[model samples]
Target: MSISPLKETIPKLDPPNNTSLHPPPSPSTHRTLRRLKSAHVLGSSVSQPSLISQQHKQSLNRNFSPTRKVTNPPPGAHTRTRSNSDANVMSPALSSPISRRPQMKRASPVEGSTLDRLIRDGPTEGDLERGLESMRLKILDQGVKSDGDGMSSLRIYVWLVLLNAPVLETDEYLSLIHRGASPAYSKIRNDTFRTLATDPLFRRRVSEASLIRLLNAVAWKLHDAKGERSEVQMRLTNTANIYGSPELQHATPAKGRSRATTLTNDGSDAGKSEPGTYVQGMNVLAAPFLYAARSEAEAFIAFHQFITTECPGYVRGAMDGVHKGLALVDKVLAIVDPKLSLYLIGKGMNAELYAFPSVLTLCACTPPLPEVLRLWDFLFAYGAHLNILCIVAQLVILRNSILNSPSPTKILRSFPPLQADIVKEVTLTLVKKIPDDIYAEIVIHAK
Candidate 1:
């Protein structure tokens, strides 16, 4: 049971010579040696596959994980240390190359949008007559809304286009204003103070000084035209007297009066004024233009064009067109709503007695500036003369109330805030119902 001493055994070997017995391996021998080394390596890997697999997996994770890097990083990039578990459970989004950004807004549709059509067609594109007519149809069909400030800008542009007001250079407008106050300055000043006093839209948007300046400029323009026309007529007459020719006499007669006889683009005479004066209620007619227009000059141009071309008679001698419009209101009412018309007539409530303000101001006498804006869109699109029928339509709508009210005149005096769309519908129907003769008169009444 006693332990014996362990003996160390060493393998005996012969002493080696300095020179190699085997010469350097040939190329084939070298290839075989490489294959044997590869096989030895393969055998070693196969024998220890689990250890190799773990190292391979670690190498893959170190290469793929954003949290680890072997080389210098780019400027502004921070070095962050992440736990092994976090690196293993990294989010794909964090590894993405591109950063996230806000999505862009898609544009709204334009097919049925009136504003889009107006912008697309513009004032100068397409055939003048056809474009205007098509635009009118679009306006009536779609009903333009003042889409806030953008719509306000659109309103002025559309009004200018509808009125056929030419755009003048800023210097020209400035020179016009430089001429100082017109002969009607006193009246313009008085009216400017009172213009749209009740309407918050006008009061908030327009200044009285602006109104005065614009009105005075327009008055001066009208005054200058009248004076020039008179001088021309006098020269023509003098020439005719000196020549004593019958042909000259006929020509002199041709220059008798230059009042516009019709409400069309071809205004009869843009120079001479029959009344030869700017009168009251013009401030109201000019209110919408000033309210919608971006500047005083724009308002002036549109208002001037409106009065001189579209409805000259409204501001001319005795405002004959306004009187005519009032009469037409009664006639139209009598035709469309005889029961209401006769009822009003029975109460001594003719248009002259009640609708003077409505006719005079082109129905701008009504309140709620937004509603007035809508009404004006129709008036500007169609003939302003249609306003008579619009008045009649109002009467028809309130027929039952007028018939039942003890004081119909008071009720009719200041029409309720206009429902432009409803009035448009009623007037359109009245167009078909009225007699041909009455319709013809309606067409020419505002001339």
Candidate 2:
């Protein structure tokens, strides 16, 4: 088992500067919306029966199954190495990640999974939150050994995607689920998922294609976590629960230095530092989703500050890209109920922080199957109006769950470190089944 030579292993690049080749920020940011809170529940406006089948058909058509479409780098995507791009852009605020640490060659394929019939058909009469707890219980009932190696492995992948959801501060994506970031899942869900994602021995044992398929299946499974299969509903059930104002939850800023990464690298002579070459020219900009992700991260920081500092609408304008990004959701939801605020706030704001913008974009672009599917369920239901609110809902859910979080700062600080598959699984658990029904907070506000 030999590791690749250090410092010169990432993709290679050679261009004094590739600024001209960069794409604008978030052009597609608003093209879609995600309903993570209630993929199925509180998901109003699904032409009823037309919801799943039609969506499933559309999903089969448009949904780019990572395992399938990731065959080649998308056209014009960066294929450069860190050293080359580093020459142009500044290094990431984060240290070289242990998650991306050198591995001993590509791992061998993991074994295939045989589905576990243990998981019941879907959520029962209970809300999605209850459904999620029920699902957790059901998964637990499987006794670890019930599902063959494949299904267990796949479920782990799904959970990883959920926990690492880019919902709130991306200080440390994985740490939030592990250690006791949010005592809710950290106490139990974290340990269980860690066992699964960290199982590289089993991962490599499975075939590559089979592993990919399993991940996709998990994405599909957790995608609906908030909806029909959801554990709780997205919105309030009673009219009185609908409060008017979007109050504060963890309005208190997370403990950490706020290091904002300006879209453009400083300097007139900036070579590869151009926004266009960020992904290729900068390791910080490696992923295609980073553009929107960076914006989303900034937006969350801004929104948090907005709640506390009540900063001017500058945050709103700054959110223009993602605004249209989520606007599409509202446009679609208006069809469901004109009276709906499109902003699915909960009287629970004092209760918790909903999905952070980070989660809204599903960890920007690296959305695991769970978040993707959860968002897909929401998108299927209310259209675009659901995006930001769902993001908010996701965050609030975390906040609520983490009421006993030992230390948000410690957890945040611990992140941006490892990339274990478990952190992600933990995220999926958070974005679980969307609700089938939800009441509005705004209506409650009026009363």
Candidate 3:
């Protein structure tokens, strides 16, 4: 009954079944098996036909081909063959020697098309209400949208509605123009010629005279508001002192004039101007209105409402809101991209140092006016103050180059022209990260 050593060493098979007792090999393990099999076949003097199929031999050679490294299959796949088209379709991240960081994609054009539906056909009252609701929801859900055509009627109409701009009386605007320019007329004139100087869209479409008129109209509006406020103050002041005070009672003509001047508080003789007077960047703000509107009066109305109501602080004597905006830009950038924020701060490049024009002009400071309009659409839809976040978004977009540069402060001096859609996408994302209290400041800072 004793078996020989060779016979006893033989392994027994399981009872007949469709499947093997062992688990199937994974792609990686299968690949390893193929490598071992290929090496044994190449080294062996005796050819084993079953172990070295012609197809498997070709696959082994393909893996070592000089042209490209063969891609591995997923964990449990059975096949290793990939066609030339599939190889070509492989992501550059996989195919290239150096992988690129993925860029923030501009929000899709479909989102824009949804907003464009507002103006695709002029909506009636019902249509307009529904369109507006749809636009507002989409903006809050995503962000407002626009395309490359900066002067689309859709854009202008959307802005007018978003701004809640009234149907201005032609007479009112004409009267402002007829009254002649404000004392800032010379300053407005100086800035108008160079506004959008190189932008072919602006240059060919809007004349210098038209730009000057719109700016002067805004200046006049500012003057009128100042005068109204001054008149109201004069009415509120006590006049009893003028009648009863000894200084006024004993006044010579000179004393009377000086006393009267002191009482009025106008200070016109000293040449002091009011706050919110025309500033240089106002010209750039007016550029978008003029470019988008069908008429100068229309531009005048939108520009007037925009500055006076939306961002009076930006144009006021100190541009205090703009300064605040710059500070907020720094704070926001820090929250989102701390490395870039700290690097800029270390380089003496806070927002004040670089973002003034952007804050003042609503990013119309940088060109391709179409992009500015696109940005404004978002600003108008959500809040103009979100621009602080938008500026931060621009800094974030440039984060990599900025961090890597030797002199980031100098590099930021003239930031690139806006890719507004991408900026809006990033900005909307950043808005959620901002603390509510700081977000409130962003809203009021521009008021």
Name the best candidate (by TM-score). Answer: 1
Off by over 4 Å in 2: 1-360, 363-368, 410-447
TM-score of each: 0.67, 0.20, 0.65
**In candidate 1, which residue pairs clash?**
none
Q: Name the runs in model 1 displaced over 4 angstroms.
A: 1-114, 120-125, 148-151, 245-273
Q: After superposition, how far is residue 384 of candidate 3 from its true place, in Å?
A: 0.6
Which candidate tops lDDT? 3
For each candidate in the order shown, give its overall lDDT on alpha carbons. 0.58, 0.24, 0.60
In model 1, the Cα lDDT at residue 10 comes to 16
Ten contiguous residues with the weakest lDDT in model 1: 1-10
Question: Model 2, residue 419: displacement in angstroms?
Answer: 19
lDDT of 1 by residue, 1-447 (tens): 000111122112112222222222122211111221121121221223221122222332221111222233358643221111111221223221111111111223234535434443432333333344445555565545454321343565556655556534333444555566567877877777878788776776666666666676677788887777767766755665577545444544444322111211134344333645588988888888777664455677778877887677888867888888888888888877778888888888788998898888878888877677877876776667678888888888888888899899778767887877788777766666777678667756666
Q: Tell me the tens digit of each residue's lDDT in model 3 across 1-447.
A: 000000011112122222222222222312211232221122233234322132232342111011123446568754533211111111122221111211122222333445545444333343333344455445444443333354343455456656655445444554565566578877877788899888887877776766776677677777888889777656644463545555567778788767766765764522232466788788888888877765455567667767876787888777778888888888888887888888888887778889988888888878778778767866776567778888888888888899899888766888798887678767767866777677767777875
Per-residue error at 175 for model 3, in Å?
2.2
Error of 2 at 55 (Å): 27
Q: What is the clash count for each candidate, in the order shown?
A: 0, 94, 0
At residue 69, candidate 2 shows an lDDT of 12
Off by over 4 Å in 3: 1-131, 138-148, 239-274
